[model samples]
Target: MEFKPDLAASNPSIDFTNELAQLLLFTGEVGVAIQQFSAYRGNLNNNFSFPSDIEEISQQPALDLMFLSDVISKVSGINRLIRGCIEINNYKELINYLNKTIELYKAYSRPNEQLKEALKGDPYKTFSNTYLKGFVDLDFAISILEAIISKCEQNNVGAKTA
Candidate 1:
């Protein structure tokens, strides 16, 4: 399916840089939760935070959160597919899920110039880390899957064929 970026869903009316930074911050949360829950999880936190530089991220920094909304959505959807495979013991589906996940991740992890080319019409003209920003987004995306898994495990609702 062709990717469609959704700015409203991805960015919730916050500062763009800190918004990305916030996503990173929650990444740590997901890691910790996975250790504890080992089942379903939720959006670890609101947004991904930035690398802890002494200076705060600029409010007017170049990147557009809108551009990344679609990527995050794609990552999130893949996580769901993978989890569904695990729940049903569908080995073939699991293999396909992993393959697609890797392929999509590679495309999403491309460099800024490539992102610009693929995305087209980047008003910011800013650079993006191959996976840094998207890593959190992808992981955050996966957290929703984690939460669904948790529900099946704990509630036993569709656990057999989640």
Candidate 2:
């Protein structure tokens, strides 16, 4: 997958740079956790004896927590970065970051919804709380991001000509 550009390279603020680094690092952790979880699940599917309770699969809960925490950190960091961009009147960078984030959110939204639906199939009603919270937070984050983007676009007249 293509990654975001080096945003900090052009940014002069030390705090923004530091926060961006932390966000990127946490994002990588989330990606790795998801990759490992997918691999583990794929392996389980190939095995002769599959665990009846999918949640009982080794490392699933831990990975879920990691994913949830990473999501929270990354989302908050993105919000902070947005504010930083606005503080510096860097509309170009702000729009770039917002578009990238929105693109990612759109790409992942369907799969996330599917997973949520799957969790609802559990008759025991014992779902992964971490997973649910992550979903809720992600939805909220996207809503906020979209609203910001709408406002930006609405006020962005003639920015392209500048």
Candidate 3:
């Protein structure tokens, strides 16, 4: 990961806490609602136009269990990463982890209308301003990390030649 001076300088404690809280609350509420909706839709016995994959999976109890298990695993992993970042006071790592969480949320959250609505408005900007204090660009941070790694590799090669 890159050593972002701004990431080191900004206060991560409050921002991380708020972000974590929001993620937990949002996922818990929205995930259950989505699952319940899926179950209800299955009970209706009418051929609703859900995605083919979802329709197939909804028919089998085993598949539904597996789907819920996968959701739990992803959410748990995200929570652990957020907490670990907070413990270490690593703002950059926290941002990276949050971005990953957002990606995962985007994947599973599409089916739920309420979740979609909640996340529709410039949620990323809200999160950035509240947690990162408007000082960091996550994409830039990732590029810096890559550059640092490349520089280190070049230095190692030069040392080998000398």
Q: State the local distance difference test value for candidate 2.
A: 0.48
Q: Tens-digit lDDT track for model 3 on 37-152?
A: 35454555455544334543344334334434444465566555545544564435434544554454354433554543664533232223322222223333234334423432
Ranking of models by lDDT: 2, 3, 1
TM-score, cand. 3: 0.36
Model 1 alpha-carbon miss at residue 13, Å: 40
Worst 10 residues of 3 by lDDT: 153-162
Worst 10 residues of 2 by lDDT: 120-129
Supply candidate 2's per-residue lDDT for 44: 61
After superposing all C-alphas onto the true structure, candidate 2 shows an RMSD in angstroms of 9.6
Q: Which one is best on lDDT?
A: 2
TM-score versus the correct structure, for each prediction: 0.33, 0.43, 0.36
Clashing pairs in 2: none
Q: Which stretches of candidate 2 lie over 4 Å from their true place?
A: 1-59, 112-137, 157-162
Tell me which of candidates 1 and 2 scores higher on lDDT: 2
> Global lDDT for candidate 1?
0.40
Q: Distance from true position, residue 145, model 1, in Å?
A: 12
